[model samples]
Target: MPQKGSRLTPEQVGLIRAWIDQGLQWEEGATFAKAPVLNLSPRRPELPGDEGGHSVDRILASYFARYGVKTSRVGFWIDFLLDACISTRLACCRQ
Candidate 1:
């Protein structure tokens, strides 16, 4: 059975339905079918940078470059950490 939260294309759904209709009998040693790979690459957004650009851009670019969806608060936390580190370096340079 496909795990929850897994995305299935129409074709995949049809195949599963057909399998079930065919009695869904196990061949005794049948292995679980591998799921079709989904290309969830992030799509580029219309705008390069917006209010969520800094945070989102990094996330989408990191994992799925084709889809330009931004990351959650965790991404923002990482950004904050980086920014603080850089600022600390600059402060030390000035002293």
Candidate 2:
């Protein structure tokens, strides 16, 4: 009594799980490198306007004014720096 154009039910999901458990090896190799690792510094913090409508710049400015340390490249500095690191030629497993 299967309905046409219906979503997968719990039993069907369990069957899929069983199939995966029985040696359903997924293809791997080079697909995992798409996302970049965020090696963030302690100086950078979770900014305001971060999906909660908080102003990141204002918060950073206030913090900088308090500590008297100028905030440079508030938003894009991390990404730009990380991108450079990725593109640079470094030693890779010289063994």
Candidate 3:
């Protein structure tokens, strides 16, 4: 028993129908239950270098080592950075 005024709009119905029409391929165990918690309180960390840091890599290395993050992610991170830069360039070109 659907109510006349309380029913979904045609656009909303269409979106839902389209989603159902496509195979609902949701990732398995993709819950954000235990995502890494970052502490961004802005404090100088004890880095392995001359008193003050030189480049961002030095700072990032300390954080990565502290968090047990591996250097393998560098390739993925570089690719992601390149993709974002390309997207930004394309957007600027469109404007």
Best by TM-score: 3
RMSD of 3: 13.7
Global lDDT of each candidate:
0.72, 0.66, 0.72
Estimated TM-score per prediction?
Answer: 0.26, 0.26, 0.28
Tell how far residue 74 is off in model 1, in angstroms: 0.5
List, residue by residue over 66-93, the lDDT tens digit for candidate 1: 5664545456677899999999999999
Q: Write the per-residue lDDT of candidate 3 for residues 1-95, one digit (tens) a residue.
A: 46656888899989888888896555897775888879878987666667443445555776888898876444456678889999999999999
Tens-place lDDT per residue, model 2, 49-80, is 44432254556766777799875556566577
- Please identify model 1 stretches exceeding 4 Å from their true place: 1-72
Mark the regions of model 2 whose C-alpha exceeds 4 Å error after superposition. 1-59, 89-95
Q: List the residue pairs that clash in candidate 2.
A: 48-54, 49-54
Distance from true position, residue 40, model 2, in Å? 18
lDDT value, candidate 2, whole model: 0.66
What root-mean-square deviation over C-alphas does model 1 reach?
16.4
1 or 2, which is superior by lDDT?
1
